[model samples]
Target: MNIKPEGRFQVFANIVMILITLIAIIPLILLTIASLTDNSALIRNGYSFVPEKWSVYAYQYIFSSGNSVPHAYWISLVLTASGTLIGLTITTLLAYALSKKFLPGRGILTFIVFFTMLFSGGLVPTYINYTGVFGLKNTFLALMIPGLLMNAFNVMMMKSYFVTSIPEEIMEAANIDGANEFSVFFRVALPLSKPIIATIGLFIGIGYWNDWMNGYIYLTKRTDLYSIQNLLYRMIQNIQFLVNNSSSLTGADKSLGSIPSVSVRMAMAVVGVLPIVIVYPFIQNNFIKGITLGGVKG
Candidate 1:
């Protein structure tokens, strides 16, 4: 088949998209450079796309003794992995169950799930439940439990994907072949639903990874249980606290100016975000597929 003049337009559009992508990526490149540059150079000179003097001092400072960044990184990794796994499992199962037409009260159950997205108990009640009833405060559970697990939007996304992508005929065929509900789900549906599963997993994982509110409220004393993001926030807080209170605490001889505050803050930002930056591409492929599935008609 001979292509039409519109093919030339498609090429032009592609070039434009490439330009836009480059524009968007420039800041990220600069952030990487700033992370590597020394504090003195950064303050003396303005921000640069390329660093004149490259130093790993900021990263070294974060990893050095008396700093809890390494522990926080480990805590975040555990919480993110655990929360993503458990949350994805529960979301997939619940969404799959609700997707089936024969399941009784599925509509009501879905309503309850959807209701949460629109209205929540607010922060006070949630805090009370986590602290008072669950006693999750100052524990690893506090980091994993609240707001990260089984979001209604993720559940709905999975249900829609399963309904549209996985044919009911295939599920029926599996049922007829002496497969139980669990067997069919594990052997058939789960495998087929990889796109949505990966999509929701990424979303929930990122939420857990970036969460600071849960740590701030629930993990007041237990610095050991702090996630990377929360730890960074606390680090920034501590720096500011020192700067503000240094005159009173340290007297006139010592000053907070000696601390590499600017570089340290930027370094913390880089550290907190680096894991997500590294892991995003893998999940992003499935995330694109998941969104495409939602757009597809049954």
Candidate 2:
């Protein structure tokens, strides 16, 4: 077959995309190298894409000193997993019902959801509600519930997917076969909508993993309930606090020798972000497919 001009253009586009991908990934590669390099060398010589000397001291520090690191890791894992599972389920079911034409009062419900995106009750009122009315302060629910659960945008995405991609005829057939709404949604629609499910799952999972605000606001005084992000936030605050108080904490004449501030901050960032970096690629293809398919039909 003779190659068309369009085919030649596509080949050129692929090469350009490859270059762009490399450009995007180069910084992450540099960060990993810096994380492995000795902090003292990094400070003296400055960071390079290539490390002068390699050490695992950062990782060692994180894992050392009893089981604090392991405990934090477990808490983060549990919160991410549980929050993602529950949030995805609720978002999907609610989105599915709202996508249906016959569902009563969907317009009002959707308006309410969209309204939340535009406005909220502000921080003080929200804090008061969660603490006073809900009594969710300093609990694991505080970490899992606020901010991370059932986002309005994610629900709209799912609703769009169901509206555009799912066939009305197929739903009618399922109803004729004596399947109830719940059965049809779970056994039929949900399975066929794997791409959207995976997409929403990734969104919810990432939100849960990266969230520190809820833990900060509602989880005061509960170090045990901190997420990995929250722990990293506290670590940064502690570093700043030490820097501010160094003159008093140490003798006025003494210096703390820089405290590995930049390197330690970078190291903490790497630690907090490592899991998402590892896991995102596994679902990335599905996420793209979901968004592409969902957007066109909806």
Candidate 3:
């Protein structure tokens, strides 16, 4: 029955992790419960974990508001998928190039990437450039191109992973075997770097999925292009306006009272993030592996 120090430490760590998991999950459980609770109960009791009454009226109000919900879902799915693939491709190519010490202008390129991480052209100029010059506003490109496409952080992480984890001798061997740079990269480098690729892909995917600012700013008149987040945001705004200005309209008081504004807000949160939470567990292993290995210095 004697236990080693390591065994005791392992048990303690498991206990700590289980407690942390509960702390994180309990709020989400409460949020879903609150979302399902009757709006009157929510307003009266202030979000009890176990409310007296339950209702799906919030979700009904949300979906019945317009035909926009399903369209928004499709738009978000396509935007996230396309943006992640394009962003990851660009990131991987740029990182692979920068990882080579002998590449001409490598230092200058690395400096530029690092400098971008520190500075930007400011909001006005960026907005003007993307909208006026590039004519990206009101287009799908607005969502995929403006800011979420690529960035220095992912590039650096991928570059660091390539340089530290991939062996120079292996690349050299491929070259000596008459393989071109493309061949070496495709056959030797990419296959061996699955963890980093999956990690960065997940990062880009989540960013695109959660992005609402792009749609809000660029798709003002292009309401059809609004993603799920943008649609829900607009719904929330409309509800708030109704609640705030209820005194102005003739029947606004009754209308506002009937709306499940309180519970609907929680329902929107659950809807916005539920898909990502469902998908994360599938790639959690590669993501953790990537972060761990890519962070090390040779």
Candidate 4:
């Protein structure tokens, strides 16, 4: 049998894609195996796919405190949900208004939005303003409003999707039929924006879930408000500090039992990313479609 050039090219492409897929998945597999491996085995043999022994000590240490893990997870979930919802509403409304070319002062408004993407007030000023003027310090609102609440990039991405994908002719027809702007937007524009909405929501949700800085900074006085990321980060930091200073300490081995070793850190990482990895499959199709259809247009 003879193979055509196209068939040969397809075979080469499939081989390359399979290689890339394995490259992406191998690290995750190793990380999982390492997390399950006993700490002693991990230290002795380093990370391996097949460890001589397995242990759940790390997971036990993580949940050793009664409800702390669950509480942090709850806080992270709430923050992600609330931030994504509020952010989507504000971004979509702003992008929709900016998509209309005939709106009064549209050019200036668009420029201001674009300008924000280029320059931002430094962190100190932002912190001062949020703490002093907004009184957000040590509050749940502090975590919800700063950083991941909304972004100029998301607004621009959504604006591009609205302008290129949605036609003005449909809006004109709806207007001609005595439909108001609100009705047109609610009934027509939003339904047509599923792909972009899903894309933005996913981005915003991940940002909120993974954010430890906001909790670390603003919630210094309120440990109860810490998110899952913040909690895990603190756990890792404490473990590292103890390990680094173990020699200097008077009773190192006695106290080292409270701290987790390498396997525990890997376990924490696995726990941190588990929810996102599980959820990605549900949104994979929409995420792919959104990126394809929502590209920026010149």
Off by over 4 Å in 4: 65-67
1-298 in candidate 1: lDDT tens per residue? Answer: 7767899889899999999989978877777788788888888886797766777787787777367777788888888899989988889899899989899998899999999989989899988988999899898888887755478888888888888999889999999998999999999998898888888888888888888988999888988787888878877887888877776785633545556667777778778778988997877888899878944532
List where candidate 1 sits over 4 angstroms from the true fold. Answer: 1-4, 246-255, 295-298
lDDT tens readout by residue for model 3, 1-298 = 9999999999999999999999999999999999999999999899888898999999898888774798999999999998988888999999999998889999999999999888988878888998999999899899899655468888999999999999999999999999999999999999999999999999898888889989988887899998998989999899999988888989997788789989999999999999999999999999999999888762
Q: What local lDDT score does residue 258 receive in model 4, on the 0 to 100 scale? A: 55
Tens-digit per-residue lDDT, 1-298, candidate 2: 8889999999999999999999988888888888788888898899897778887776665556233666777888998899889998899888898898898898999898888788878889988888999899999988877854468888888899998888889999999999999899988899889998899888888888888899888887888888778877877787688778887785623434635556766778788889989998888988998988766635
Between candidates 2 and 3, the TM-score winner:
3
Tell me which residue pairs clash in candidate 3: none
Q: Report the C-alpha lDDT of model 4 over 74-188, residue by residue, as the tens digit.
A: 9999998989899889989998998888899988998998888889987899999999999999999999998543588888888899998888899899999999989999999
Comparing 2 and 4 on TM-score, the stronger one: 4
Q: How far is 3's C-alpha from truth in model 3 (Å)?
A: 2.5
Angstrom error at residue 54, model 2: 2.0
Of models 3 and 4, which has the larger lDDT? 3
The candidate that achieves the highest lDDT relative to the unseen native structure: 3
Output the TM-score of candidate 3. 0.96
lDDT of each: 0.83, 0.82, 0.90, 0.88
Compare the candidates by TM-score and give the number of the best one: 3
Q: Which has the higher lDDT value, candidate number 2 or candidate number 4?
A: 4
